[model samples]
Target: MDSLSEQQQQASEKPIINITGEKVALGPIRRDQVPLFYRWANDFNVLRTLHIPRPSTFEENLAFFERDVEDEKRRTVVHFTVYDRASLTPIGRVDLEEINHRDRRAEFGIEIGEPDYRGRGYGTEATRLMLDYAFTGLGLHNIGLYTWEYNLAAQAVYKKAGFREVGRRRQAKFMGGKLWDIIYMDCLSTEFVSPVLSKIMVPDEVRS
Candidate 1:
């Protein structure tokens, strides 16, 4: 291969941590991936696990991408694409949303959009990776999330990552022919725990 081509190939092969764990890696959401984003957004199964209950149009999804980027610039939101490490292919996404900088907190959510990638514990690891970034990297004190009451599996993943249920909005969402509560949970910075710390560290005044 030509020298420039070789470097490009090497870059693709190298694991970019961005945010990482054993089975998955998180990295910046690229504009070109908006098409994939739209596909996931329209997937019934995908939206079932997310806050948005209705299917989104291509234009709406595109607008969301643009808006997320804009909010990221203002430091109120951040988005990351999840990748399977073995194949280096994008599988889903996780995001820190509605970030309250003044309160040192943010809301979290994640999805494993690929059917094949589900039920493999990838979501749990990705959650921890994001928590690591939130508590240490961003210096946020609290990270919160809400899951559909029926999404017990997702809640298990959050619990494994040290989150505890703080409250619930009863019968807040009607879906799949019934109503479900919105289970609210949060983890404090002091409570955040992750193996990613072995690879990355952010210090405070005591360490300085």
Candidate 2:
């Protein structure tokens, strides 16, 4: 089969759901999905919101997959492929990186690479699910993320997921013929009530 057909076939298969949500599910990132990641990395619409905001080659994406595998093994990062729960189609990615178990904190990052999936509630659902995993599954106390000043949509999503704007780095990024601040937002385990993990982790007696 041709590459496009093969990708579609693979995507249609039932994915191993790690964290389920209302509108989306999180699954392990597969090696076969590197081509999709490459396409998203190169898409300007997606890249513009990312911290680096640069086109990535396929080889670089391959290298990223390899590195992600190692990082996951070392427990320094946790990555997931965001899937549309209804269609089971891969739409984006969300990850908690720079994990410090001792400090109980990590940096959060997410991208809805598929433009069709943007402006929907998928990203917010995915973020909440990740937060549940981070706080309850991994016992993390704090999770932080950054976004450019121009990305109002992302800020709203993060806020809806329990993150509050803590600060900003003034004129930290130059894009689209203007400089923008790097806005910082974060949420603590105390501030968030786990939507999924708590039920699984806590006993009925303690929960009541």
> Using lDDT as the measure, which candidate wins?
2
lDDT of 1 by residue, 21-48 (tens): 7899898887667888888887887777
- Cα deviation of 45, candidate 2, in Å: 0.6
Tens-digit lDDT track of model 2 for 1-208: 9999987787657778888888999999988889999999898877778856676799999999999999999999999999999998999999999999999999999999999999989999999999999999999999999899999999999999999999999999998899999999999999998898777887666553
List the candidates' TM-scores in order: 0.85, 0.90
Off-target runs (Cα >4 Å) in candidate 2 are: 1-12, 203-208
lDDT of 1: 0.85
| Clash counts for all predictions | 0, 0
List where candidate 1 sits over 4 angstroms from the true fold: 1-17, 51-53, 202-208
lDDT of each: 0.85, 0.92
Clashing pairs in 2: none
Q: List the residue pairs that clash in candidate 1.
A: none
lDDT of 1 at 81: 89
Residue 65 of model 1 has an lDDT of 90
